[model samples]
Target chain A: LAKTTQPISMDSYEGQEVNITCSHNNIATNDYITWYQQFPSQGPRFIIQGYKTKVTNEVASLFIPADRKSSTLSLPRVSLSDTAVYYCLVAHGAGGFKTIFGAGTRLFVKA
Target chain B: DVKVTQSSRYLVKRTGEKVFLECVQDMDHENMFWYRQDPGLGLRLIYFSYDVKMKEKGDIPEGYSVSREKKERFSLILESASTNQTSMYLCASILAGEDSNEQYFGPGTRLTVT
Candidate 1:
């Protein structure tokens, strides 16, 4: 299992882009970088995932360098509703059962 | 959309009480998981099931058990609840063999033991 490290918290103004990066120095070859977002008192929802290069979705974008040791989750034009805890994880396909979620980056989008 | 539903949003129990947290998914997913979330621990997996009657222990499985009697329902059991066990419990499910590692999650159950 690959351990992930992320910033404890971050602050961003509304309409601004927010980028949170995670470090996983021991990522395996079969590991994929995945991100999830959680609101207060709610379960987390998948944001974006990527193996390498860049992957974009409706909610967020995931960027992985060639080394795959670190990944960044980019939120474009963040809103107040984007205030939540974002988790970064490394796991194989459908093998999220073994994934470990460390203390995620708590993003506070202020208006 | 895949919907995962838990039996309760909030639950209160005594220290020695037996607790059962039920989770059901509308999608017929083969993999179901139980996790507990804490202030600083993030989300810790407790147990998971790949198919009915087949289960595996996760990172934190002490004082917890699970049952998967059907394809869409998974249950977490606490034989003897403790105050230390008070936390938000989350349930998730995903289809086996899918290329994506996306797991649909339930709203979560806040369990408090006195």
Candidate 2:
């Protein structure tokens, strides 16, 4: 399992774009980067995932560098409701028991 | 939509009492996992089951055990609950052989042992 390191917290204003970066120096070839969002007292929700390059979805975008050592999760036009803890996980494509979630980045969306 | 349901949203138990946490998923995912989340420890895996009657210990499995009697249901058992076992327990399931490692999580159960 590739361990992920992220900032403890980040602050952004409403309508501003937020980017959270994760560092995984020991990422493997088969490892994929996945991001999840969790609100207070709720389970983490899947946001976006990518192996390499850029992958965009309606919710967020995942950008992976060529080295695969780091990835960025970009949230566009953040709102107050988007304030949550964001987790970046690096695991194999078929990750089952090998999945690990570290202390996530707490994003505070200010009005 | 993938839906995972836990037996309880909150539970209170006394020390030395037996505790059971049940999780059920409607997607029939083959892999079910039990994890405990704390203030600073994030999420630590206790046990995971890949198939019926098959189980594997994760990072933290000392005070926990799991049973998967059916494909959709997995149960976590704490033989004798202690005060330290008080934490939020989360259950998740993922389909096997899927290209994406998307996991569906249930509303966590906040267990308080006094």
DockQ of each: 0.77, 0.75
Model 1, A1-111: lDDT tens digits are 899999999999999999999999999988878899999999999888899999998888888999999999999999999999999998865556587888899999988
| Runs off by more than 4 Å, candidate 1 | none
| RMSD after CA superposition, every candidate | 0.8, 0.8
Best by lDDT: 1
Q: TM-score of model 1, chain A?
A: 0.96
Assess candidate 2 and give its lDDT. 0.92
Count clashes in each candidate, considering only residues at least 3 apart in sequence or on different chains.
0, 0
Stretches off by above 4 angstroms in model 2 are none
Scored on chain A only, each candidate's TM-score is 0.96, 0.97
What is residue A94's positional error in candidate 2, in angstroms? 1.9
C-alpha positional error of residue A3 in candidate 2 after TM-score superposition, expressed in Å: 0.5
